[model samples]
Target: MTRHLIPLLVFVVIVGFLWAGLSLNPREVPSPLIGKPAPEFALPQLRDGGNIVRAADLRGQVWLLNVFASWCTPCLEEHPYLVDLTRRNLVPVYGLNYKDQRSAALEWLGRHGDPYAGIVVDAEGRTGIEYGVYGVPETFVIDKLGVIRFKHIGPLTPHILNEEILPLVRKLQT
Candidate 1:
């Protein structure tokens, strides 16, 4: 009877852990980079590989660094909001073209609409590794002094843009 009871208790504990994990949202996973200086990189521009976009060039302003790939479906979902934000000109949205062929990324943006102030080609994914990118469609909000204020993993929804990203940008701008 005692041996049977020990196994039952172990099973119950495992079930409890599973239940707790299921209750948590993946999107809310905390980023360690927040409030820290953004990792710097100098990469070729997507449109003209000869031209470079360095992280240092954007130091004195609030900007959005969107990490996206042409193959990502969620990137397409979040694109319209990015376009809208660009039109509003609230902040300069910079694109990090991660792990994609240059021509494919160019075609995707041209077809969707080119919404970035400038696009950086992360073709080798070295920049993505520096930023600790687990997947495509991650975004970072960087303040005037080059500190990463927030990171949004996955795609940005209208609710997330309005409620979190924009509000944080506004606060940082002033």
Candidate 2:
């Protein structure tokens, strides 16, 4: 009877922990790199394969580094917001094409819309690893001095753009 009771108690404890975790939002997973300098990379441009884009080149201006892949369905949901932002001319948005074939990416862009100021091909996903990307469609807001200001883990929504991203970008610009 005593041995059976002990196992029951341990199972209850494990179940309690699982219940607690289920209540937490997965999108709120804290990134250790927040407020730290963005990891730098120099990757070939998607549009012009011969050209390279260095992360360092974006210093002295507030901008966004959007990690996406041609295959990511959620990225399609986020693309329209990015396109609107680009048309508004609010801030320069750079794309990190994570681990996707160049032709596929180009075709995807053509099918949807190219919202990036420049797109960098992360062909091997090494840069994505350096940026601590948990998955595709992560976005980073960097300040004028090149520090990562905010990270949004999922597809960008109009509410998130207005409530969080735009407010932060405006604050950083000044």
Candidate 3:
């Protein structure tokens, strides 16, 4: 009887684990880099390959680093919202063009709208990996001192921008 109960106990434990996982939100996956300094990088600018944008250069400002790709469908969905956010000028938004061609990135930005104050090309995706990017359309909120405060996975929606991102930006700016 004890031996038979072992299998039933194992099944119960598995179910408990699954239930815990299901209760958690996928978009809110906690990033280890939160409260830590953002990864340092120096990548070529999308508009001018001759110019490089360094992570260190952006100190003393609260900003958003949006990771996007031309081929990512969610990125297209997120673009207009980012454009509108830039119009507000609450915080500077920078783009990391992850693992995409320069020509395609430029064309996509042209077709939609250029929202970024500056865009850096991460054609090899090395910088994205450094930032712990699971996929395209991830965004990071960095404080004035260069510490990462928040990380949002997936596309930005009006609700997320209004309820979460904007509030954090406002607090960080002050």
State TM-scores per candidate. 0.87, 0.87, 0.87
Residue 11 in model 2: shift from native, Å? Answer: 17
The sequence of per-residue lDDT tens digits that candidate 2 reaches over residues 24-119 is 997677988899999989899999999988889999999999999999999999999999999999989999999999999999999999989999
User: What are the per-residue Cα lDDT tens digits for candidate 1 across 64-104?
Assistant: 99999899999999999999999999999999999999889
Encode model 3's per-residue lDDT on 70-153: one tens digit a residue.
999999888899999999887899999999999999999999999999999999889988999986899999999999999999
Please give the lDDT score for candidate 2.
Answer: 0.93
Evaluate model 1: give its lDDT.
0.93
Candidate 1 vs 3: which has more lDDT: 3
Model 1, runs deviating above 4 Å = 1-20, 26-28
Q: Put the candidates in lDDT order, highest first.
A: 3, 2, 1
Question: Which residue ranges in model 2 land beyond 4 Å of their true spot?
Answer: 1-22
lDDT of 1 at 130: 86
Q: Which TM-score value belongs to model 1?
A: 0.87
